[model samples]
Target: MGILVFDDMKMLDVSGPAEVFSEAGRFGAEYRLTIVSVSGEPVRTSIGLRVPADAAAESAPPFDTVLVPGGDLLPGTPIDPDLTAAARRLAERAGRIASICTGAFILAAAGLLEEKRATTHWQHTTLLARSYPSLRVEPDAIYVKDGTTYTSAGVTAGIDLALALVEEDHGPDLTRDVARSLVVYMQRAGGQSQFSASLQGPAPRTPVLRLIQDMVQADPAADHSLDRLAERVRVSPRHLTRMFRSELDTTPMKYVELIRFDMAKALLDAGHSATEAATLSGFPSYESLRRTFARHLGVSPTRYRHRFTTTRPAVDATRPALPDVPGNR
Candidate 1:
C-alpha cells in the first residue's frame, strides 16, 4: 500500500493506517507501506511535525491502495492542478481509494467521487456535495463504501475505517490484534454525528416532554412560547418546567434551544443558506444563530455549511417525521 501524503495534510490520515499496517508485523508480515509526497522533500504535518516521504509521487511504485487526509482549506480553494492530477493518475491503478475527513475534498475535486455514495467530516459533507453534484453524500454515515472507494468521517473515525480495511484484507483476528495493541475502541458502530450529539446534554423523557420534542422538530419555527406549549399540552408552564427537569434533565427553555439547534443543523445540512437556516430554526438573528452554534457545536454556521452543505435535498420521503421523542442518531 502507498499512502500519498500532501501539504497541510492531517498527519493521522497517513499515520493511522501506516501504524495499522505496521502493526500487522505483530501478527505476521502481511503488507508493505510506502509514504510519498508531491515532492521528494520532507513536508510538515498539521501539528508542525516533520514527516519524510520515501519517494516523490512521480517516482513511487504502483500500489494497490491510496489514502488521503483532510485539512483546513477555504471554499473554492485552488490547488496545484498538476499535483492533484498526479494523485488522480495514481488512483487509476489503486484497488481502493480512501479518504479521512476533508481529504475527501481532494478526491472529489479529482472527480473520483462522481456518482459515488461517500461521506466526509460532517461539517464538510454539504460543501463536498455542492462542489461535486454527481457525488451522493450521506451525512449520517460514519464511513461510506462506494464501490472501490471508502471514505470516512472526521479525525478519529479514520482509525476505525483503517481497522475495517485490515479486517477486509487480512482477517478479523488480525484487526483485533491491532485494536488491542492500540488501546482504542475496536469499532464505532454509528456515524461520527452520534458521538458529536452525545456531547449535548441529556435528552428529555415523559409524555409532555416528549410531545414538546415532537412539536419542536415538527416545526421549530412555530411560535412555541413555553406558556402556549404547556397550555396546549394541558399543563401550566411551571409544571412543564418541573417535568422537563424531572424527565429530560433540563429546563424547558434550554430544551427548546437544543431542539432549535437540531432543526437548524438539519436545515443547514439540507443546503439552506445560513440566513435562511437561522430564521427557520427560530433564532432571532444570524448573530443568535452563530452564538448558539459556537456554544453548542463549537463551529459557526458558515463554517458548518462549508463543511456540510452543498445543495439542499429533501429528506427520505417515506420515513415518518420525528416522533414524540428525540430521534436516535
Candidate 2:
C-alpha cells in the first residue's frame, strides 16, 4: 500500500492505518507499505513532526491501494493545487482508493469523488456536502464504501476503515487479531455523533439552565416535558425552550432523551442486557431504547453493547475478553 503524504497532514491519519497494515504484515500479510510526498521531501505534520518520504508521488509505482489521510487545515482551507494534483496522479495509478477524515476534500477537489458517496469528520460533513454538491455525503457514517472508493470519519475512524480494508483483504480471523493487538474494537457500534459534541457539549452558562439540566439528569425517566421542566425552573414553557436552544442548542424533551440514552449506554457497557439497560435507564420500553440508539448511534442496543462493552458477552465467541477503555492498558 502507498500512503500519500502532504504538509500539515494529521499524524494519526497516516500512522493509524499504517500501524494496522504493519501489524497485519507482521502476522504474515503481504503488505509493502510506502510513504510518498509530492516531491520526496520531508514534510511537516500537524504536530510539528517531520515525516520522511520514501519516494516522490509522481515517480512512485502503482500499489494495491492508495490512502489519502486528513489534515486539520483541510476542512475550511483552499485545496493546495500541487497536493491535489499529486493525489490525483497517485490515485490514478493505484488499484483502489480511500480517504481518511477531511482527506475527502482533496479527493473531491481532484474530481475523483464527484458522484461517489463519501463522508468526512462529523464537524465538517455539512460543509463537504455543500461545497461539493455532486458528492453524496453520509454525515452519520463511521466509514462508507461506495464501490472501491472508501471514506471515513475523523481521526480514529481511520483505524476502523483500515480494519475493514484488512478484513476485505484477508478475513475476519486475521483482522480480528490485528484489532486485538492494537487494543481497539474491530468495528465501532455507531456513527461519529456518539463521539461528537451535539449530545456532549459544555456546561450550561446560567444558573437556571444548569438547574434545569440537573433535574432532567437526576430523573431521566420522569416526565420532563417542556411544561414540567418550565415549572421546575419557574419559567414559561416558551422561555425555557428558547433558553435550552440558546444554551444547549436542543429542546427540553430532546435533552431528557439524550440523558436517558447516555444512561442506557452506561448500563449496556456495564454488562447489562439491552432489555435491562432500557428498564434501568428510564426508557419506557426496550423498543424506545432501541429507537433512540438507532437514531443517534446508528446501531441497535445489543450491537452497541457487544462492540463497546468489555463486560458484555461478545458476538464473536472466538475472541477473548478485552478491557474497557479510557486509555490503553
TM-score of each model, in listed order: 0.62, 0.82
- True-structure Cα RMSD, model 2: 7.1
Q: What is the overall TM-score of model 1 with all chains considered together? A: 0.62
In model 1, the runs with Cα more than 4 Å from the true position are: 74-76, 190-194, 198-329
Compose the digit string of candidate 2's lDDT tens values, residues 13-56: 99999999999987777788899999999999999999999999
- Candidate 2 residue-wise lDDT at 235: 92
> Largest TM-score belongs to which candidate?
2
RMSD of each: 14.4, 7.1
Give a tens-digit lDDT track for model 1, residues 294-323. Answer: 775555787666532111112234544322
Clashes of each: 11, 0
Off by over 4 Å in 2: 189-203, 212-242, 266-271, 297-299, 303-329
Q: In candidate 2, residue 317 scores what lDDT?
A: 45
